[model samples]
Target: MARRPRLEPRETRAEATQAFLGRAADLAAEFAAGTPPRRIRSFSEAAPDDLRPALAILSEIPDLGLVVHGPRGCGVRAPGPAPLAVTDLDQRDTVLGSGEVLAETLRALDAACPVAAIAVLGSPVVAINSDDIRATVAALGPELGKPVVWVRTEGVRSAVPATGGDAAAEALLQLVETQNGPREPGLLNLLTSTRSPELAALAGQIEGLGWRVNILPAGARVAEIALAGRAEASLVLAPDLLGLFAEGLETRFGVTRLDVALPLGAQATVAVLRRVAALGRATGGGGPPAPPRPLSEPLAGRRLALALPTAWGLAAAELIGDLGGTVAVLSVPHLDRSHAAALGSLAERWPDLQIHVGEGQGFELAGLLRRTAPDLLLGAGDAVVVALRQGLPAAVLDPARLIGAAAPEVLTEAVDIALARWALVRGAVQNARPGYTPGWLKRSPDWHIKQEVR
Candidate 1:
């Protein structure tokens, strides 16, 4: 007898919501200060934009060359396993019209860099000077013999760090727009925030269904990225951050997007595979591999904190409670309407759950941790260090290990180890000096964050 697949609660699935950029929580307290966290989404979407840490996101596209067009001290070094070119715009260049310098930089990079394509990322200085990036790119793109695109990422564009990701996505899409190629038969673009084994495994499942999958923007081939418009459909692995790319593909190339959630846990993953198979107009492929049932309440009676992206964090928060742990503090980089359903579901279950939004503000994080005092911390990026300094047993959230069939168990193991090592983690930091002044620590976590003048 053929058995039916497991059916999780409807709330665990994707909900319809709108996405906007801005002031994603630079710190969790930004939303919680004197208002309901859910009500924070009701605010206007006209907040500032930041093209931050986007270069980091772009660099991972192994075949894409990057040129950071900015002043020398704008954190412009190549945090690379990938090659990067910096324009090295000095104070003088800022005043004297840096267009010539930019043109010269592009030509120089084209000569030396042996990558598939080059992208010029703007800095706050270049953006203010109003650099004619499009004109320059158009002029030199043919001369350079490959795609040269302008990625508008001045530091202050949007307060959302993922805006950097969006800019990079658009730049990649521009590269695809340049190609006038025939669509490849059975090709699908798997759009994901990071290239993970779990996603790779999911890609394999789609491949088994006889589709050619090109995972994009992150870990995408320069060849594949250039020809993305040729794909039949775009499957979003993390829609909260990458929905823009999917929508753009649909608009520009007429590629259909399967607006699915990041397939973490078993149910979500199974749902994704079926959707793909259905889209292909074929159902003959065997059932997708089912991940084992996760242990219930692996973290029972423990208070935990999560610092993750919006969708991933909400899913993980629910999973934590399912496995027997309580998530007291929740921190995501940004929140928009696209996340309303997931956030609403979370609110329904854990009414008192502290919702904090931020990306890498250790000062504010210190205050958040003090307020929540979670037994363990699970997160990614700069926030991990802050957790360590305060002696909390912390684990980094790896997108690679956190999705697909085994994500639930993978998270459980990580959480268990973190909780078990609390004594060791705390003991090591017992003699450490405080990273902040007493005044700052005592002040509200959102003290430094300026409120919008309405």
Candidate 2:
């Protein structure tokens, strides 16, 4: 029997009401009152786009060497488990120009790794110095017989962290030779993070339908990236992570993207597989997997708060609702317009779901948690600590685990476990002193957040 799609609600918004979702920039923009303000309770509702996105993609390509160019404190480490070179600039270099150091750094890395390609990541200092990296890379790339690309990762330039990933994708795309006449039938490109057993399982499922899958930045060779222009279509594992990359591919290579929600719960996963199988019909080998039955709605009547990355938090809300949970509030490290439609859909479904956007706002979260008093707290590391300390049932969910056929159940099981320990969690909360944060600060999550539009 065919199962109906879930959470496919009509897009509707209240005619008169408007709500604000906070962002990290709001907190950072606040002018400190004193030389060192009484104490800042800084945090955002969403995860900040850090250098991890840039590093994750660069380190995934096989034999790709990295060279970080910036001040010593910039900490320009490449993403992933791969090794690379770093050119730490001092105060003198910032004023005098680090051109000589950059040239020497590239040469040393090339000599050490002899890689097919080299990626240079820029720090705030490079941006400040107005470094002409393009001219340098153009001059050296031909002589080295390898593609040399630069990713502008200067923290001062962009308020959003994912911009680093965009810069990385733009650089890496230069390495792809889009001259492969036409896309091969049944070829699909997947844009996500590195290799994992869960991804392998997904690949196996797609392969079972007679389609070949190529995952980017995870076991993908330089040549494979070059051939990406020839893929029939592309799918994004996490829209927040790869939306821009996919957009670039579509713009440059004419690869159609399956713009859908992240495949988390059963219904969402089924939707993804069905779409893949439908695309596979051209190659004569796709049959949708058995439709997932309606979720039993285990979290019904439960109020929960979610502290997660923007995209994941929104999707998880829908998933939680499907399982009968109410996401009363969500805290994202940041917010962007890429998934405005999806966010809108979620908002339509849960109009009263309060959203707080900021970065590392512990005091704010503590206050909000106290006020909301949700049944469970679902988020990543710090959120877990906050909840556990407050005696709330808490579940720590790494964004990576929210994939594959079992993702929904994994989250539910964690929620169940946390709930089972309710008494213990409460005991810990009861014994703790409430003076960790002051009464004034705990009054509002945005106590120090500036009220301005960036």
Candidate 3:
């Protein structure tokens, strides 16, 4: 037999991501076979001491059971009082085969609790034969009549706590769909993992449209999610997590799927809303149109800069142009080629705009602002620093604030609200007299106010 191909070294997170994606592709090919593909639990070499972050994320889903497989006295904490069941894979099991241990664990779980899914947390020893452990679970799942979700975190070393969170989202999407009954006209379900402050607000906005927004594993339980199968359509906001699920929902539930661009600014937002409106009309869920509003207030006279992820920056710039804003600069690290090309096209379309690309360095924004003197900054985290230094009002629009299997419409609405708030704040700041106290400062009663008597 020919020698197996040698694997290349991984030196960066991007490289690791590519490797992971490759593995996912291979798994997808395997899944195409009649048998179910093995589940992935975590991406770490050794299970971390605290699984709270992961467990807390999983707890959002009702009737979800976590099965922790480790040697006795392994010191893995059980998830807080939520129907969680744990099984110890002892030393003897590791030396021999994991088949018996896993079988016993499954039997115990089947008798004691309701098991919807099973995730494996790799210890140093367990990581050795993760494939065998996975196989053991798969063999037992059919016997127990439950789906097995395995996360293979064999050789990873990153400290990113959300790896398990992503795995959980993936598992849920695999199970939930929109096909329990006949489709409801004008109703849409927002597929998301968890609710952030921004996402919560977006859900409210969609609800205002008389659309029943179903947030998966966040505001709604598993039963409610099953009921969401009847929604007229589904919107996928977090592409990475919701993409696979959206495809499944369309196939199983007969729900129309809209894979619109994520809304980050005025133009993308309007486009998304229009698409949603069209979907509603098609589904006989049409309602009276809200009064037409200007795409954006006059932005042409003002200078603005954006610091965000690639797609978000592009969308923001497009919307800023719609509002007549002169985009002085835009920046984001890890700028993919497509985003770069899009930015180049936008620059060619609007020659007056200036754009910069860089990672979030302390001096980067200050230096750019000194040269460009932008009137406003739209960013997630680092832009706040620019705003403080330059006395320019800034908006926070972090994508992390929109976690989980978010519906596209809900994502669009969240961005719309954030942009609106940012624009209003910037406008108020621009209209204020120089040295006028900021509203945020006034709102803080604990702050010392020095009064000058005339």
By lDDT, the best candidate is: 1
TM-score sort, best first:
1, 2, 3
- The clash count for each model shown is 19, 22, 21
The prediction achieving the highest TM-score against the true structure is: 1
Using all chains and alpha carbons, the TM-scores for the candidates as numbered come to 0.84, 0.83, 0.53
Task: State each model's CA lDDT, in order.
Answer: 0.69, 0.68, 0.51
Of 2 and 3, which scores higher on lDDT?
2
Per-residue alpha-carbon lDDT of model 2 for 109-189, expressed as tens digits? 888875888888777677667666666777778878888876756545344565566667776677764334577788889
Off by over 4 Å in 3: 1-59, 67-127, 139-147, 151-170, 177-187, 194-211, 227-230, 251-253, 263-270, 295-310, 320-396, 399-454
Q: Candidate 2: global Cα-lDDT?
A: 0.68
Question: Candidate 1, residues 1-454: lDDT per residue as tens digits?
Answer: 2332321111122221112122224212323343322212323323433444467667777777777778766545435445676788877778776888888877786677678788888888875677777788888889888888878676464445566666766787788888758877788898775776777788888998878888876776688787788888898867665677788889988899886766777777877877787766542455544544645666779898888877788888877877788888877766654666666667667767777655555766767888779887888856677888876788887756777768778887888777677677676677778677788778777554443333
Worst 10 residues of 3 by lDDT: 13-22
- Return the lDDT, model 1, position 310: 73
Total backbone clashes of candidate 3, pairs 3 or more residues apart or in separate chains = 21
> Which scores better on TM-score, 1 or 3?
1
